[model samples]
Target chain A: EDKVVQSPLSLVVHEGDTVTLNCSYEVTNFRSLLWYKQEKKAPTFLFMLTSSGIEKKSGRLSSILDKKELFSILNITATQTGDSAVYLCARTPNNAGNMLTFGGGTRLMVKP
Target chain B: DAGVTQSPTHLIKTRGQQVTLRCSPISGHKSVSWYQQVLGQGPQFIFQYYEKEERGRGNFPDRFSARQFPNYSSELNVNALLLGDSALYLCASSPGTSNNEQFFGPGTRLTVL
Candidate 1:
């Protein structure tokens, strides 16, 4: 079974504090890793990491993958209260047509 | 471009009842996938359809089924619903089967009482 594990199931940080979420996966025919932010019911797409070492960034959020180590990390700098949500990490297998195996997710609460 | 849209934001049913959830993918998208997410857990893959054909399915039981229409819209049917079936059913769409970036819908919260 393909499994994705996230660390620090939940976190509470101040508005200005920075946070890093970790995810490790063991999937067959690994293709890529994707990050999403779920605020209410819908999950908004963040970044899709396919190459290792190279980092992908958008505004204050960034992510990097280490395929060699089979792990990935998402960094959110200078967080705001609006950033409070569940961060999800999913892995796509090359053989499973568009199937995304997701982790339990990390709940982040950014205090004002 | 309207993204992916799902119908009936919320639904309630009882055990042994049947329910159907509908989804319309983004314009020009040819692939649609379904997922079920319980509270506090990430969404789990249920099925994938491309060009009105079923391409893949998850480990869900036979009671759960789905089909895509020629217009690229899809419907998920669950029969003999169990209390455990209460979940947020999500629908996603992509331009192609090989694309990993899928646009997700707002999801339908199904409550089985």
Candidate 2:
């Protein structure tokens, strides 16, 4: 069975602190990886990475995938209270337009 | 364009009663998927429909069923509900089969008594 795992189930940091959330997956046929931020309801899209060594970034958030290691990492810079949310990592498998297997997620709390 | 949308922000039902949750995909999106999220846990896949056909299903029980309409809207039905069936049902829509980026709705919170 395919699976996704995330580390540091929860984190607390100062406003300017930088945080790194980790996600690793073991799937039959790898396709792509996606990141989402959830506050209280639906998850908003963040980034999608398919190739290794190449990083996809947006504003203060960035992510990269290491297919060789079957893992990915999301980095947030200059964090703010508004950035506090649950970060979810999911892996989509090849061969089908199917569901994404998500990690437990990293709950981030940023304080000013 | 409008994003994916779900109905009845919240609901309450007794055990053994049936429930129907609705979803409207983002305009121009041909695929719709449903997921169940329990508090403090990641969303669990339940069903995926594209172009009015079932594309995939999760490990949920037979009591859980869903279908997509010609307009690309969808509905999820849960029969013989139990206390364990209570959860937040999320709907997502994508433009095509290979599109991995799905837009999610606010979700419908279902409570089983």
The sequence of per-residue lDDT tens digits that candidate 1 reaches over residues A1-112 is 9999998899999999999999999976898999999999889999999999999999999999999999999999999999999999999988748778999999999999
Index of the highest-DockQ prediction: 1
After superposition, candidate 1 runs with Cα above 4 Å error: none
What is the two-chain DockQ of model 1?
Answer: 0.78
Interface C-alpha RMSD after superposing true interface residues, each candidate, one decimal: 1.2, 1.1
True contacts kept of each: 0.75, 0.67
Model 2 bad stretches (over 4 Å): none
User: For each candidate, what TM-score against the reference?
Assistant: 0.98, 0.98
What is the model-wide C-alpha lDDT for candidate 1?
0.95
lDDT per residue for candidate 2 within B30-95, as digits (tens), equals 999999999888888999999888888999999999999999999999999999999999999998
lDDT of 2: 0.92
lDDT of 1 at A28: 64
Residue lDDT tens for model 2, A3-110:
899988999999999999999999779899999999999999899888999999999999999999999999999999999999999888787785777898999999
Question: Residue B38 error for model 1, in Å?
Answer: 0.4
